[model samples]
Structures are given as C-alpha cells and as structure tokens.
Target: MNKGQISNTLRQYRLLYPLDKLRYLVERNKNKKLNEKFKKDNPEISLPPDYLMYESFQIDYSKYYFGGKTTAEWIFKLLGKHINLSGGKILDWGCGPGRLIRHMPDISNDQSSFYGTDYNKESIQWCKNNIQKVTFNHNNLEAILPYEDNTFDAIYGISIFTHLSKEMHFNWFNELKRVLKTGGVILITTQGENFRPKLTGEERKKFDQGELIVKGNVKEGHRTYSAFHPDPFLKLVFEDVDILDKIVISPKNKGYLPQDRWILKKKALV
Candidate 1:
C-alpha cells in the first residue's frame, strides 16, 4: 500500500475495530435472517451482506430503487441542457450496490452505456448479479482506476469525494480527467458551507481559510471520514475545467440536508 492508503487503513482500523464487532452482532444477523426469508420467495435474487451496505444502511428494495431513479432524473434534468444524458457513455464513480447505476437503463437510450465502479468488492459483486444493462467494476481506494484515457463522456460521483482526505482530491480529479473524453462533464457534490456547523473549532478555522478539513478518525473512504470544501477551494482545485454551474441548495428548498453541487466540463485538448 502507498503512504496514503497506509494512513487510511490505520485510521479505519482504529475506528472500526471494536464497534464493528458490536455492529455485526446486532445488525448482521438481522440482515441474514431477512435475506433467508427473502430468498425463499425470490430464489434468483441476491442481497448484499450487511457490511456491503453503505453506512450500514438498509431499506426496502423498491424504495431504494425509486430513490436511485429519482436521483438519476434530477441529474438528467440538470445536465440535459448542455449534454445528452441519453446517448453517451456515463459512469457512476462510487456507485454502491448499484444505487444510481441501476436506474441508468431507464433514463438513457439503448446505445448509451452505463458503468459503475466502487472500492467495495461485495457491492460490485452484488450489482453484477442483480442489475441489468450496466457494467460494474471494483476499484482501489487510491487514485488509479482501470480505464483507458478519453473513455467516458460523463462521470459523476455521489457523496464519494466527501469522505476523501484533502490530499487525495487533486490526484483523484486528475485521474477522472485522464479517463474522460475532452469536453466531457464531471458532476460532483461536496460538503461545502452546508456542513460548516458540524465542524470542530479548528476545522472551522481551516475551512474559513479555504483549506479542506477532514475528519479522519473514522474509515478512510467511507462516510466515517468527511471532508468539507469551500467554494474557492473547489475553483482552485479544478482550474483546468470549465465551471458550468455550482448550485448550493438550501435545506428548506430540498427538505433534506443541503450539499453544494458542481458541474465541471473538461477542456478540449489542444
């Protein structure tokens, strides 16, 4: 492992070691029991084990599927004016258990290809077994991804970068750019000013100075670790890209916690 991965692993172990045992004792068994009953009725279906669930989150399959579709619709609407969401190669960069990628077939044309990649092997396996018309791959936590340059027309990550440490942002963004077609759009969300109140005093001060503040005591690449970005920091980091839109949604407007969304278009190669 590289230095960053080593640091992340150490931090992840510290946070998950004891709590993981308790979580398995309480939640894992419950999921297994439910899975057994579910399989009896729908023999072909496969449900991911509890650990594979993002944030240990569990919900009815239909509701989860609907949520994915609705999110896809919102993204389609937002990027539709500038690009064709229905007719190009698109990627869901941290797709967990086929959340958003599962809905792509419904929103896009048959010619459009959908791909999903995540660091979680179990989630990728579950998606491969269950979701149709989408390719899923497992990626390492670090910057390197197994894709050719200039491949995807568009790529988006929902809540993925929020967990990364500040140092990883530029490398990760460059990797995304490397694989993206010139003029491709990258739609990503960040925990911006919306998460300001949740910061510690020191973190808040750092955030005010346009530095990325990371809570690293928890898992390195999961929700346990959260990084907040200020607007200026985002623009500075993505200097090579064209900022098409930066929407900061308020909680009152969305009925949920707000997040700042950035739509960036990669520049055409000279």
Candidate 2:
C-alpha cells in the first residue's frame, strides 16, 4: 500500500476500534469541558464536542468558534442566490454534529424546516440531543435513505462527495434527486482540479483524463477514503440535473486545497 493508504488505514482503524473508542470518549469529555469554559467566558459562542468540531470544521481549536458559522454562511449564500429558502424543507446531507445546521436558525427564515443526517450514529445523536429546531437522523452507507421521496426543496452536502467512492457518488446523486422535489436545488462540493498537486502520479494522470480518482480502500462509508472529481466527470455523472453554478472555493485561502462547489437543480417533470 502507498503511504497515503497506510495513513488512512491507521486512521480508520483508530476511529473504528473499541480501545480507540474509549480513548476518544475520554478526550471528548475533556474537550467538552474546555469548550464549555470558553463558551461561558465568551457568553455568545456555541460549542460542541471538540472531536466532532474538528471533524466538521478544522483541527485548530480557536477556529472552531467561527468555522461553523463561516461554512454555514457560504451554504446560505449559495442557496439564497438560487432559490427562496424561506418556507422550504431543506436537508443538510452528511451534516456532521450540526456544524452547519446549528447556524441555520440564525440565517434562515423561521418558516423553513431544517433537517440533517449523517452516517455516523454518534454525530447524529449528539446533534439530536444538542441542536434545537432541527431534525437529525442517522443514515446507512447505502444509496437508500429513510426519508420519503420528494421530501426536500433543497439539499446541501459540504465536502461530502469528496469522500465517496465512484459507485457511491452516483448512488448518492440518484438518492439526492429522489428525495428532492422537482426543480429543487442541490449543492455539493468536491476536490476539484486544484487538488491535483496533492495527488499521486497515477491519480494525477487519471484526474487529467477527466476521470474520478478514488484514493485508498473504501469500507463502511467512512471519511478516510478520499475522491477527486474532475469537472467534466461531474458533469457527465450528474447529467440528469441542471448545473447552475460551478466554482473553486479555495483560492481565497492560500494554504487549503481548492474545493469545487456545484449548485444544481433537479429537472422538472417531463
């Protein structure tokens, strides 16, 4: 296995193993206490578990105070420009510990009903217990979700497709389309062309050929496996949906890999 694969495998094992779970539980409680103290001093800040905060946002503890809000604002901007989000049912696909969903109430109209789901049961449970005014659920790795068809007027998955395998990508696209109302909006982010420099030689070649490049082994739909989607491949894969906007969002942040954002609309009934 390549170095990247080795590192990812180790991380996956750490996250999945029982002994590591106990370690994380202890760390989570300690971090929660620190976060609580910080919030108490600040009086206007919201904080969740530090481990979950890192998963959804950044590893830097200081940034957690604003990272979720910044991401939520970006999502709100993208959705707001395309549709009236008020009085609509919106889904935060792959919402991790309510990072973005937690800030929705502050940015969205009161009539809007926000829902969030993630494959991680722990994250979903944490969101359910802590975040108010939103519905949270756990989803399996399969293409099928628990929600009814045509349930959401809009859905957004920040950095979600970036981790899925090729098969899961198409499966999720169909599932997202199935849940969205006709003409409903869907937003997704992927590791785009700008991330090519970080790819291995073989992965870079595949990416240059407009192919989807998946890194390492994929199992149980964990976020350890990474995928890079070329723009053309995304267009072909999402042909059933209308592409409204596509842009690389990392140039502004000099050190980060560029994540391409795509805003799409589910086709109206023929």
Q: Give the alpha-carbon lDDT of every model.
A: 0.77, 0.79
Worst 10 residues of 2 by lDDT: 12-21
Structural similarity to truth (TM-score) of each candidate:
0.82, 0.84
* Count of residue pairs whose backbone atoms collide, per candidate: 0, 0
The TM-score, computed over Cα atoms with residue i paired to residue i, of candidate 1 is: 0.82
Residue 127 C-alpha lDDT in model 2: 85
Q: Give candidate 2 regions above 4 Å deviation.
A: 1-37, 43-46, 218-220, 250-254
Which model scores highest in TM-score?
2
Q: Model 2: per-residue lDDT, tens digit, 1-270?
A: 754455455656664344445655665665666665666678755556666765555534445656777878888878989988889999999998777888887788566899999998888998888788999889988877789999999999988888788888989999999999998999998888777766666777888899998764445355556788898889887998899999875575647766888999999878
